[model samples]
Target chain A: MAADKVFKNRIRRKLIQIAAFGFTNCHAGNFITGKLYNGKFKEFCTPGLNCYSCPAATVSCPIGSLLAVTGRADLKVSFYVWGFLLAIGAVLGRAVCGFLCPFGLIQDLLGAIPVHKFRLPKILTYVKYAVLALMVIIIPTVLILATGRTAPLYCKYICPAGMLEGAIPLLLTHESLRDSASVLFWVKLAILLAVIAGSVFVRRFFCKIGCPLGAIYGLLNKVSLYHLTVDRDKCIDCGKCAGCCPMDVDPVKAPRSAECIRCGACKAVCPKGAITIGFGSGRKAAKREGLVDMNVYSRK
Target chain B: MNKRKVIGIVILIAGIALIAAGVFRGELDVILRKAAVVCMECIGLG
Candidate 1:
């Protein structure tokens, strides 16, 4: 199958933009290294829903921070966490996974390499919901009650993001951390390795089948302020939108499907220009041909 | 191969290895203690 020309280039442009941001912000003085994104000058955290814990993180991980504040017995006002999640979700939704998440970006680059892809069974997809319910919420609450201390348990134990963005960097930068590898660290490392390797065989099997955050953000595909709209009038029912969906959404029946990540692949591939992205009152529906000159690059 | 099945098997094996590591040290309780913390802390369910 030929790769979609416009999607490929759009993806590359997004990656380059992220890489350039990373490059410009690599300076520790500018990046704000530590728990507070405020101790000195404020720097842009990767603008995704990643956790803020995991020691090597220069910018705060939002989900981790959110859970931390939420799980806290203290009940302090988590203004940063609330504001950050709201602002990002309101503006971009899960487009963060497609365009901005450093870890998601890494997985996509790995997937872009030629490999035998696997079609995961649908039953496994529920695992992410279980993770969200059990790990993210229930477990943390239980632990806090038991120990009177809270931690981002999922990020600490299960997130490959912690391994990539936290553990590896800390290990590389600190010799003491190398000697301090507990069995738990090895377990997380092994999982990280599997996730990285698995991306080659499964298109975001982690995000599709195991990511609690994806499960949460994906729901916004329908009602999020920014969203995808499908024109039933223009849709030829070719199933191209569903075919193009990386998260396996049936764009025909539920164009705002929970699994839709708003990656806009459906928009790029719609033969009849049936799908579109819209915001606020300017959301007048249009046929595909209406957006003929609307280059995909500029929209993002 | 199912990733969860693979993870389950790995966890089982690791649990066994940890038991052995404890038995050799003549401190079975230590293994349980270590694993208990991890199980509670790592599984995200505490």
Candidate 2:
């Protein structure tokens, strides 16, 4: 029975990895021809942080799309983009971060490399929200509204995912793109290298501290349909669930913590089978049981 | 049938409808034009 369960878990991880790669790089022609794919699919945004500039990307990154709209002088708020983000957040929350994001997958793989792992300070988790507010929303919006100038501050200056997936590939394939590279390119490259190095020591370092998209989705995790649920009756408070959590979320105390990426690592590790990934009224039940603190609920 | 579920469903439907309306109204043209290029600025070329 244990062997069967292990086999099932392996299969599930493999399937999710395959889905993540396929969804992000579905534009086969772009990869073959070494060009960007401009199609109707490009009109839509993917649930994860796949860069639109990626050669094989058929869809847009929601953060990139939001930044693009925010940088426009004529548009104040993109109802479509905001609505899309809210909808995705309300439904899936950070499950998209866990199972869908190509960059998240890369971080996971890098984290899997044999090394001494360290836990990040819980305070560091709040940085992504600041990135969301400053880099993604506030900076671009203020620039467009105040100066009538558009700048995707996050993508141009901050997004390591865009650097790794889009810039690196384009630089390799198109010499014209290489000519355009400047100091900013080196800065982005340095940031990507730092993020990659951090991933080796800390699981999901970028997702935990830097991804504005993850931060946005994390906000909706409390109200999202899909989330982790803990059964207080079955939980022994063994601390195993908290130990296994890559994102540093304590499932027993806050099953639907904003920091939770819904990787199911806790669920897999729970000896009591108290933690579950499901859609239901588990949030309220946890609240009623006093397992969750109302202050933390609202503060996060 | 919880309050959270009800609110989530409503938001989900509204979001889908909004995106659909935007697409029908040709908001996608903006995205199409942007995606067609390599976005040199985005990749830190500028």
Candidate 3:
């Protein structure tokens, strides 16, 4: 059964990677826009984390949109942008990272290049919160106040997403873009390379350590109305769940651990039908796991 | 489908719908034009 789960995960990972590539590379199709739309600019925005500045992006990045909205002097709200993000995040969670984020998919592919991997110290996880507070929130807000126009600080200065989605594609097509490279771009590129290299040793080093989006999604792990639970009595304590967890969460203690990406690794590894996912009462859930005796439930 | 799967399908469908609406409403085209203008202005390409 564990083997079957592993096999399924492998298949799912491949499918997700392919979908991400198709979504990311959809920019390749936008060149037709030049002829179809008669626009002086060759590119249009594709929505998500993709930079519209990238020669390849058929879509725009959400972070960019948020910045653009905040940057605007007009106080009017953008229902479309906010609605789009909520809908995507609520429906998909960080499934975007697992299934459709182009940059994330690239990182996964690069990590697969076969090299020594690294184990992360649990403490470094706090860095993502700081990143979220500073880059996505404080910096953009400050820029909006100062310039009346805000750039995506994370995307421009720190996001490997931009480097992969925008910088790489544009550079390949526009030679001048390469000559204009700033120290900032190279620094981000270095970070991207380091993360890519680190993924070889660490599973989802970026998501685990740095992705503000993932940090946002992780906040909803328990309350997203879907979560994992352990039937402790049924749990043989075989530790198979931890063995299977790519992020190294101990399921018994932290089934709904924010660190858990909800990849279903622990559930698949539980030999005794110990772990189940649902919205349920914790006591009843504990009973199902045999943590509480059936006799105990009956008395109530 | 499971919750995760349901969410996945919904996002894919909604994304397609939003994109289509933007095209049909002509709003997406307008936004694109605006974005292109801004991008060009930023880079001084036009």
Arranged by DockQ, best first: 2, 3, 1
- Per-residue error for A181 in candidate 1, Å, reads 0.6
lDDT of each: 0.57, 0.81, 0.59
Winner on DockQ between 2 and 3 is 2
Query: TM-score rank, highest first?
Result: 2, 3, 1
Give the worst 10-residue stretch by lDDT in candidate 2 chain B: B21-30
Superposed model 2: Cα runs more than 4 Å off: A1-7, A28-32, A282-300
Q: lDDT-based ranking, best first?
A: 2, 3, 1
Q: Predicted chain A of model 3: TM-score relative to the true chain A? A: 0.79
RMSD, every candidate, angstroms: 13.9, 5.1, 6.7
Give the better candidate number (2 or 3) by TM-score. 2
CAPRI verdict (incorrect, acceptable, medium, high) for model 2: medium
Model 1 C-alpha lDDT per residue in residues A62-125, reported as the tens digit of each score: 5564454545565422344444444454455666666666667667778778977777787887
Q: CA shift at A139, candidate 2, in angstroms?
A: 1.6
| Candidate 2 clash pair list | none
